[model samples]
Target chain A: MIARNNVVEFRTDLPGYPWQIAAGDGETWIILRHKARLPVTQIAQLKNITMKDFNWRIFTKALSKTLFQGTVSLTVQYSEAQHHGEELPRETWVDEHLARESFIKDETVTGKNIVRKDSRVKTAFSSILLDKNMLNTGNESPSEGEGIWHLELPWQAWLYGTGKHQNPQVEKVHIAQVGLNTLLLEILIQLTANNELDLLNTQLLEYGLLPREELIFKIEGQEIEQILGVTVQRVFHQPVYDLESKKLQLRNFKEVDIIFISAEKGGERILTASRLMEEMQVIPFWPRDWKRPVDFGLFNKWLGLVKVAADQILFQGDYLWFVRSIEEMGTEKITALEEKRKNTLVAALPPPRKKPGEKWLKKDKKEQPQSSISKKAITVRF
Target chain B: MVWQFSSAGYMRGQEARRPEVLPQANPEALPEVTVEGLPPQVLSSYELKIKSAERKSPNSWLLNTSQGEYLLRELPDQSNQAKTIELYLQFSEQGIANLFPLEKTKSGKAYEKTEGKLYYLTHYRKGNFFKGDDISHLRLAAKNLAILHRQTGGWRKEQGKKQNLWLTVKQNRLRDLLAYLHYLKQNKVLTDFERLFIENFDFFYDQGQESLEHMVLAGQEEAFIINNLLPENITLLDDKLVFLDITKWNTGPQAMDFSLLLNSYLPLHRWDLDLIKDLITQYHQENPLDQKARHLLLAQLRFPRRYWLYSHQYFSGQLSSDELTPKLKRYILECYWRDICLDQLENWLIGEWDKNDSKE
Candidate 1:
């Protein structure tokens, strides 16, 4: 069921390979090599399983009774042909993959290298015709053996999908690639959920899955303006996530990509890229970690309160109300702390000594006659 | 009033009445004992033994006494020194201590009245004169003024009467300007000052009228303002501002103080818009200013106050033709830069107002 721009073809030229089968939408292709003859019924069942229903559990269960022996390899590719002429160089993709691999390797908890050797950029030549619209301008005709670089993953067909799907069909392939990071995240989440404190604590140290490198894809400035609903002068990315200390928990994809937006008028706002993605409701595989610190929840509550106060300022045109609210909150906090201190240690402390001039000043003021005039009746005229 | 004099005070009174103890012809020389016409009973009433007395201004004296150094000044005709003292005492009671309260006499009177004149004493404060050139000083002064405003703002609920004081002030000035124009036109032979006043009359008249219209539109809020907030009246001592003069405190629009401060200081900076903005922001941090207050402030700033002042002075013969001509010329030249700054400020204010309106 591949589109015309994403036709996958198989070659049976190699000597050791008997059956060469390829099936997928162009970005993610499943290549199968069978030692035993495959039945027509099993092939029909495999075809019926679209990418949405395709998951590790379903794949394994569907093939449980099949008396077949074969190897299934998954290849994920990013190419200009698949995207709408978006140029993601093969070198850039390879660099990102290596960076992610290095990040996983640097983690002390995951001491063993989890990245498989087969998960590398593998060059393949395909003369499959593409839709005219898929071709880049000035390249009216492409020759055979055009280099198509792709990652040949060691993952079997059973480990391919995790059941999450994006809205647009085209983003499904990229979402599948992102699912690899999600899988690693899921392990951490499950460890935490299962109350395996010792293991979870060990893994929580430097346990990020995605590379903290800048992404090849960028959200345009106009899109950012739409998300913030403010006139943006400039947007800056400030990366503050620390994988070694695990300071900022990996609750969202691209959490470190914090946007510092300065508006045209005079104010500034900071927002996380993950928060923006959450607002956009895109990026399906971004799973939020449920077991967050209580401080984070309180901080979010304060942020919401500030936003409500700001709305009050805007609606009522009483800016002082917002300032007073903040001051009151501060005063309440200080008073609460002072009360705690007074209850604990104040009784043991000696009373503060009066300054040398204090007594005299007090006596002098006391000696003055109380005026008969009411303050309300007194007005100083110029 | 019955004067109570102690046995020692009778002798001091006899000594103060001597001609040698009176004000000398050379003001540079300190008086031997007491100020001119200051009754010895007034000094003895405060239990003050004067060491030396020096004239500081027309009706003020710097006195060093056995008690302490003090500034003794006479109040003007419209001044209610008792009410001023009460207001400041109330302010001090309310924990607003920026102003120096009036020191009471031994009889607990706020001021001593003798020969139909009112005189009061206060502890002499020492500080450097406030510098308008220093931005930090400007910000501090603005913040302190705002604090004073906030304290007095509460009084609005209790005592302040709502009045369009700016409208009255602007109308008076405009009337004076029109009278000056008529006087200049009536002159059979125009002097240089009269000629200059006639030439610049139309532009300044339009500006005055425009500001009056703006004031009318802004209406009024009950605001107790320090009417004379000149830099000379503020002192910066040990990072704390001491408002030296509280006698001119009056009930008016809150913008009156802000406008007065800017008018007094903007000439030092040649009317820099950013500096004005910064000062406003500093003030706003302490006490929030509404859009109407800002409009009134801008309106007051836009009016050609100096133009009117010089013309009125010249027309009333308070200033000679030779004296008024140069001052008016310089003022007209300065108005170019002033107008540009005011226009930019107006644009910014309009833009902000529109932005807030759109938000609503």
Candidate 2:
């Protein structure tokens, strides 16, 4: 902590992203949007984990991401600031710790960066979603419109943030609308009956962990712009306000890791993932195994991120963003933050090695025991 | 007929159009019968019933829809809480009833879960003077519980298979008391009343945790269910009594279930514990009261509010309404907190209670 004629101590934790805090000393800093990283050693672990166990990689990466990015506030000793002589006309005082802007962000914004480019499943499903009120399609009326309130982006949507989980082909687009049927309503009503379900359900009200809403889905196996047989609804574009409907209030916000994997159709695709690259996009992934530079279905590989636009899940925090307005300076700062973010990512990517009996270009000589593979076609009762 | 529509936009109750209800009949009864009157369900067998009426669980549905009424239970799956079904006879005037052995699909499964928890459907036995109240009948039940302990002694032991936290907790306390016993060659923690209990434990544990289990298997409340009887689970048709839904755990010590009942259900000048000694004395074979068990029971009796208040706190609102009447709830809470401090006096000497009462 360095004391000056005016400016207080600057932050030393983020040395890579330095701050020149001598304001009007002509020293200015583009305050980094966020601090995130995945070291080189972690990458090796992730690689080993990916080869050794798939779920281990997933759970590990999820946990690691949270551990690295989890925000915890701290406060050291601070004494009352010696007030400046100049009648700090608001602005100057605003910067004062006494009047310091707590830096509250909008908690949400127009979503972007959702798409995958893997060559796995045949084609991908992609849709666009925008904040509902962005269009200002205002309609204040009686009758059927009573429940129709302002459609603001949710303060915290269920599947908001996380590294990535989707197809590998859809072009980068600002998601416009996503149709979802959080099974929360069914769970709640089913629980209110005071039967055995209600009794068992009582054990699940912990924070950031609620009984997940059974995902209402329809998959035709073939790529269609909309899920086949499933009519798509508009994005759940709404404010964080509860609509007073027990159904709406009880909505479960959760984060799900949906991994889409495929090799050269017939190649062995198992690997370790004990550790992982903290931050990376859909591109520039280097997989082992030679010949033909194989991949999964690239066209529909990426459908984008699942942004529900509300705290509709207990698993969230990855998809949130905030900028006072679409100001270029703020957005530019964010971009710079994104750039610095990439360094920590590539450095930490796990370099997986083929096991002793395994070969890069060769598929395994033996298949897994029949008992290990799942046979039950996880059926959902409509 | 569906009763209501929940916010999830689905019909509630019998006609909710779930996949299909599983049958609750013996598969051998109807090899190929399609129960025409029932909703579309996957049933193994079909049979005649006198009637059917919707009832709260343990007995989910009382069937008078035919000649002889049966009980149908809609079970929940992966459910943790245990409720009695399959065996408790409810002979209420609600309908016609008859007693029959448990009937299950030929697969020999007593219950099955389709969309929810498992349910059991059985013939309701005809009976009289069945007090179904939650906590009474334990007094009369003391003897019946003893009989059950004697009868199902072997099979039930095989059923429970594992010891819960009981033996370990008892032994942990005993090692300290046992060492004290060795040091003083006397029961240090027990009064003469409790000394008997400690001796019981010393003698019991001398044989080990298995001995405790044996005591349980052999109808020992000092090692199992207390002898305090409740009239609720008992059926006294002019002294021809019956006890069912009987478990190895609930049929122990004469003090096990009875003392608590007197306190909880009967409005008395402080749950007349006088009934406890009497109940224990009445047991057909007087198992000597281990001084240690006496001490433990009295100590436990001293903390009765804890067991009742806490038990009620977690599960029961039936004693009160949705449990929201805060003043009453507050009174219970205040008594609980007050007792936490005042209980020391009550635990050591009842006179302290009168002293505190006089000061107040």
Best candidate (score: lDDT): 1
Give all TM-scores, in the order shown.
Answer: 0.41, 0.27
Docking class of 1: incorrect
lDDT of 2 by residue, B65-90 (tens): 33244555554454332223322221
Off by over 4 Å in 1: A1-382, B1-37, B47-53, B65-68, B76-79, B156-165, B179-189, B353-360
As a whole number from 0 to 100, the lDDT of residue B349 in candidate 1 is 71
How far out, in Å, is residue B36 in model 2?
14
Clash pairs (backbone) in predicted model 1: none
User: Candidate 1, overall lDDT?
Assistant: 0.44
| TM-score, structure 1 vs. true | 0.41
